[model samples]
Target chain A: MTPEEEAQLKRARRGRNIALALVLIGFVALFYAITIVKMVD
Target chain B: MTASANPALPAEWRDFFALTKPRVMSLVVFTGLCGLLAAPGTIHSVLGFTAVLCIALGAGGAGALNMWWEADIDAQMKRTAKRPLPQGRMKRTDARDFGVALSVASVLLMGIAVNWLAAAVLAGSILYYAVIYTIWLKPRTPQNIVIGGGAGAFPPLIGWVAVTGEITLMPVLLFALIFTWTPPHFWALALFVKSDYAKAGIPMLPVVAGEAATRKQILAYSVVLLVVSLAPWWIGGTGPIYGVAALALSGAFLALAIPVALRRAVEGDAMKPEKRLFSFSVFYLFALFAALVADRLILGQGALS
Candidate 1:
C-alpha cells in the first residue's frame, strides 16, 4: 500500500477510537447520573 | 463506495450515522421531548433527559434495522437509493448488529433509569417498525403506512409514560392525533412518488388504489385527523390556547388538502397541491405539538378546568 493510503487508514482508526471512547464515557456518565438520581429519590 | 468491498476499509462515521436516518430521528426526538415536557408531573431533569435520549437511540436503531432490511428495495427506488446500506457504504450485517445493539441497550437503560412500562413501549415500537412494518407489511400490503403509522405515534406516548408511569387520555389522544394524521401525510407524498413505489413493488396507497382513490383517502384521513387533533381540547385535556391553535391548523390542513382532493393533475402539470399539503403536514404536526406544550406550561396541570 502507498504511504498516503496507510496514513489515511491510520487517521480513520484514530477517529474511530476517539468516537468509541466518547461513547463509553457517555454511557458511564449516564449510568452514574441515573444511579445518583435513584439514590436521592 | 467502490472501496466498500475491501474488508479492511473503515466505514465513515457519516455513513453509519446515515444508517440511523438522522432527519427522521430528529423529528422522533423532538416529539418525544415535547411529550416528556407536556406530561402532567414533575420529573428530575436528568431522568427526563435520559428518557428522551433513550427514545432517540431506540428510534435510530429501528431506522438502521429498517434500512438494513430494505437496502435492496431501497436501491431500486430513486427516493432511497442513496442510503448508506443501499449505496454499499455500509455492510448489511454491521448495520443489523448496530441496530440490535442500540435497541437492546436503549430499552434496558430506559428500564433501569426510568420505568419498565416506558421501556416496554419503546422496545415494542422499535420492533413494530423494524419487524412488523418493514419486514411483514411494507412489501405485502398497501395498508402498510396505515398500520405502520402506529410506530411513529409511540414516542410521545412513551415519553408521557416515562413521566407518569402509565398511559392516560391525553397521551392516547396525542397518539391518535399522529395515527390519524399519518395516512394523509404519507399519501400526499405517495401521490407524487407513485412511480418509485411502483418500481420498488411496494404497494403504497397511490400505487394500489390509483391517484383518484388516494386523493379521496387523503381528504378522508385529513378530516379524521381534524377531529382527533381537537379531542384533547374537547375532552378537557387542554385549554383554549391549544384548541384555537389546533382549530386554525386543522382548518389550514383541510384547505390545503381540499385543493389536492378537488383538482386532478394532468400530465405535465406540477403536483403543486399535493406537494404543498405534504410540506404543510410536517409543519402542522410540529406546530400542534408545540402549542400543546405551550398550553400545558401556561395553564399548569388540569388547565382545561
Candidate 2:
C-alpha cells in the first residue's frame, strides 16, 4: 500500500474505534438509568 | 479524495452514520415525538426520550438495510450513487450486519425499557420497510409506494401505544393521514426524478404508469389525504387548533396539487408545480403533526377516547 493510503486507513480506524467507544458508554449509561426508573416506579 | 478512489482504505465512521439516512430519521423522530406528546397520558421524561430513541434507531436500521439491499440499484441511480455502499466506501456485509444489530438492539431495549407492544410494532415496521417494501414491492409494482406507505405510518401508532399502552382511534387517524399523504408526496418526486428511477429499473409510478396517470393518482391521493388529515378533528379527538391547521395546510396541499394534476408536462418543461407540491407536502405533515401536539399541550385537550 502507498504511505498515504495507509495513513488514511489508520485515521478511519481510529475514528471508528472512538465512535464505538462512545456508543458503548452511552448504551451502558442508558440501561443504568432505565433500571433505576423501573425500580422507583 | 473520494472513498471510491481508494478501495484499500477503510470507510470513515461518518459513512456508517450516513447509512442511517439521518435526514429521513429526523422526520421519523419528529412524528414519533408528536404522537407521544399528543397521546392523552403522562410518561416520565426519560422513558419518553427512550421511546423516541428506539423509534429513531429502528428507522436508522431499516434505512441501513434498505441501502444494503438496494446498493446495486443505488449505484445505477444518480440520486443514490454517492451512498457509502454504492461508492465502495463500505462492504455490503458490514452494512447488513450493522442493520441487523441496530434492529435487534432497538426492539429488545424497547421491550425491556418500555413495553412489549411498542417493541413488537417497532420490529414489524422494520420488517415492513426492509423486507416487504424494499425487497418485495419496489421492483415488482408501480403501486409500491401506495402499499409501502403503511410502513412509515407506524411510528405515530407505536409512539401512542408506548404512552397509552393500547391502540386508539386518534393514532389510527394519524396513521391514515401519513399513509394517504405518501403517494402524492412520493409521486411528485417520482415525476421529477423519473429518469433516475427508470435508469435504476425501479417501477416507480411515473416510470411504469406514465406521467399523466401518475399526476392523476397524485391528485386522487391528495383528495384522500385531505379527508384523513381532518379525521382527528371531525372525530372530536383534537380541538379547533389542529382542526383549523389541518384545513389550511391540506387546502394548500390540494391547491398546489391541482396544477400539477391538470397540466401535462411538455418537453423542456420545468415541472415547477410538481416540485412545489413535493416541498410543501413535507412541510404540511410536519406542521400538521406539530399542530396536533399544540392542541393537546397548549389547549390542554384530554386524551382521545
Candidate 3:
C-alpha cells in the first residue's frame, strides 16, 4: 500500500479506537451510577 | 462490492455512526422521552436517562442490523446509497456484530437499570424493526409500513413501561396513535419517491399498489390517525392541552391529506401537496407528543387512574 493510504488507515483505526474507549468508559460510569441509584432506593 | 472485498478507502467511526440512522433515532428518542415524561409518577432522573439511552441504543442497533441486511437493496436506492454498508466502508459481518452487541447490551442494561418489562419491550422493538420489518416484511409486501409501524410505535410504550413498570391504556393509546399515523406519514413520502422503491425492487405501497390507490390509502389512514390521535383525550388519558392540539393538528393533517388524495398524479409541479403532507405529518407527530407531555406537566394532570 502507498504511504498515504497507510497513514489514512492508521488515522481511521486511531479514531475508532478512541471512540470505542470513550464509549466503554461512559458505559462503566453509567452502570456505576445506576448501581448507586438502585442501592439508594 | 461486499465488505470482504478490498475497498479504496478505510472505514471511519462516522461511517459506523451513520449505520444507526441518527435522524430516525432522534424522533424515536423524542417520542420515547415524551412517553416517559407524560407517564404518572416520578422516576429518579438517572434511571430516566438510562431508560432513554437504552431506547436510543436499541433503535441504533436495529438500524445497523437493517443496513447490514439491506446493503444490496440500499445500494440500488438513491437515498440509501451513501450508507456505510452500501458504500463499502464497513464489512457486513462488522455491522451485524455491532448490531447484535448493541441490541443485547441495551436490553440487559435496561433490565438491570430500569425494569424488565421495559427491557423486554425494547428488545421486541429491536427485533420488530430489524427482523420483522426489515428482513421479513419490507421485501415481501406492500403493507410493510403498515405492519412495520408497530416497530416504531413501541418506543413510547416502552418508555411508559419504564416508568410504571406495567402496560396501561394510555401507553397503548400512544402505541395505537403512532401505529395509525405511520401509514399516512410514510405513504405521503412514498408518493413523492415512488421511483426509488421501484428502482430498488422493494414493494412499497406506491410501487405495488399504484399512485392512485396509495393516495386513497394515505387519506384513509389520515382519517383514522385523526380519530386515534384524539382517543387519548376522549378516554381521559390526557387533558384539553393535548385534546385541543390533537384536534387542530389532526384537522390540519386531514386538510393536507385531502388535497394529496383528491388530486390526480401530475408528471411535474413537484408534488407540492404530497410533500407538504409528508412534512406536516412529521410535525404533527412531534407536536402531538409534546402536547401529551404538556398536558400532564403544565396542566397538572396526572396519569390515568
Candidate 4:
C-alpha cells in the first residue's frame, strides 16, 4: 500500500477507542437510566 | 465545465446552494426545531430561529470539514469521489478555512443567542466529527461511523437545551433514537459501498466485520433503535399517536433490515436490501421526528416561537 493508503487505514484505526468509549457510555445510560427514563421529563 | 454536468449546480446562482449538504442540514433543522417545540419553557421566536441557525451552521461546518479532511480518501472511493473538493472544482484549503470559520461562528452565535450549553454541545459535536472522528477514527477503525454518529445526533438535544436550559429525558430519548439509528443506517450503505470504502482504505463495518457480521450488527442495532424510538411515547414524552406511528415506521425499518441481516453477500445476491434500508433509514428518522412535532402540534403544545 502507498503512504496515503497506510495513513488512511491508520487514521481509521484511531477511532476504535473512541467508539468503544462512546458505546460504553451509551450502554451505561441504558442500565442506569432505566428507572428514570421519562420521555417527557 | 464539471459544474455544468453536476446535478446540484443549477443554471441559477442559487443552484450552488444545494451542495452544502442541504438534505443533511434539513434533518438537523427539523430535529432542532422539534426539540425547541417540544420543550416546556418559552423561547423567543428570534432566539429559536437563531438556535436553528446555529444547528444548521454547525452541521454544515462539520460537513465541510469532513469533506476537507477526507478529500484524498473521498477521491479514491466511488461513493464520494465526486464531492466538490475531490472533483477539483473547490480548493481544499478553501474548504478547510470555510469550515473553521462557520464552526467557530456558529458556536459563538449560539452561545450569544441561546444557552451556553447548546453552543458547547454544538462545538463539541463539530470537533467530534471534524477532528476526532474524521482525522482520527474514520481512516483507522471499523467503528468510525458508530462513534462519529453522535456528532449528528446532538442537534435535537442541543436545541432542547437551548430552549429549556436543561437536559431532560424526552430530549435524551431523541438523542438516543438518533444515536442507535446511526449504525444500521450507515451499515446499510457500507454493505454496497464496501468496495468504495475498502478502495479508499477506510475500515467501514462491512469492510472490517465481513458481510455476515455486518448484517447481524445491522439487525441488532435496528431492533435497539425501534425500542428506543418508542421510549418517548412510552415514558410520556409523547402520546400514543406518536408512539403508534413510531412503532409502525420502525416495523418497516426492521422489515428492511432483517432480510439483509439474514442474507450473505457471497451468494448470488444483489445489494438491493442494503439500498432499500439506506433509502428507508432516511425517511425513518425524518418521519419519526416529524411525527413527534406533529403530535405536539395536535396536542396544542404551544409553538417554540
Could you give candidate 4's per-residue lDDT for residues A1-39 as a string of tens digits?
Answer: 556545544553454445557746954564344324323
Residue B223, candidate 1: Cα error in Å is: 0.4
Better of 1 and 3 by DockQ: 3
Global lDDT of each candidate: 0.88, 0.91, 0.90, 0.78
Candidate 1 structure quality by residue, lDDT tens digits, B269-296: 7899999999999999999999988998
Clashes of 2: 0
Whichever of 1 and 2 has more TM-score, that candidate is 2
By summed lDDT, the worst window of 10 consecutive residues in model 2 chain B runs over B1-10
Model 4 residue B162 CA deviation (Å) reads 1.4
Q: What is the C-alpha RMSD of each candidate to the true structure, in Å?
A: 2.3, 1.9, 2.4, 13.2
lDDT of 2 at B81: 92
lDDT of 4 by residue, B1-305 (tens): 53333333212212223234777898889888888887777776667777888899888888888887887887887767767667765456767776888799889878866779889888998999889998988778898888877877888898889888887898888888899999999989888768777777888888887888999999999899889999888888788768889999999999999998988776656788899999999988888888887887787566564
Give the Cα error of residue B199 in candidate 2, in Å.
0.9
3 against 4, candidate with superior DockQ: 3
Q: Enumerate the candidates' DockQ scores in order.
A: 0.65, 0.73, 0.67, 0.02
lDDT of 3 by residue, B185-256 (tens): 999998888888899899998888888999899889988988999999999888899999999999999999
Please, what are the lDDT tens digits per residue for candidate 2 over residues B60-142?
99999999999999999888899999888988899999999999999998898889999999999999999999999889999
Q: How do these models rank on DockQ, best leading? A: 2, 3, 1, 4
Q: In candidate 1, residue B52 scores what lDDT?
A: 95
Question: Which structure among the candidates has the greatest lDDT?
Answer: 2
Stretches of candidate 1 off by over 4 Å are A1-5, B1-8, B301-305
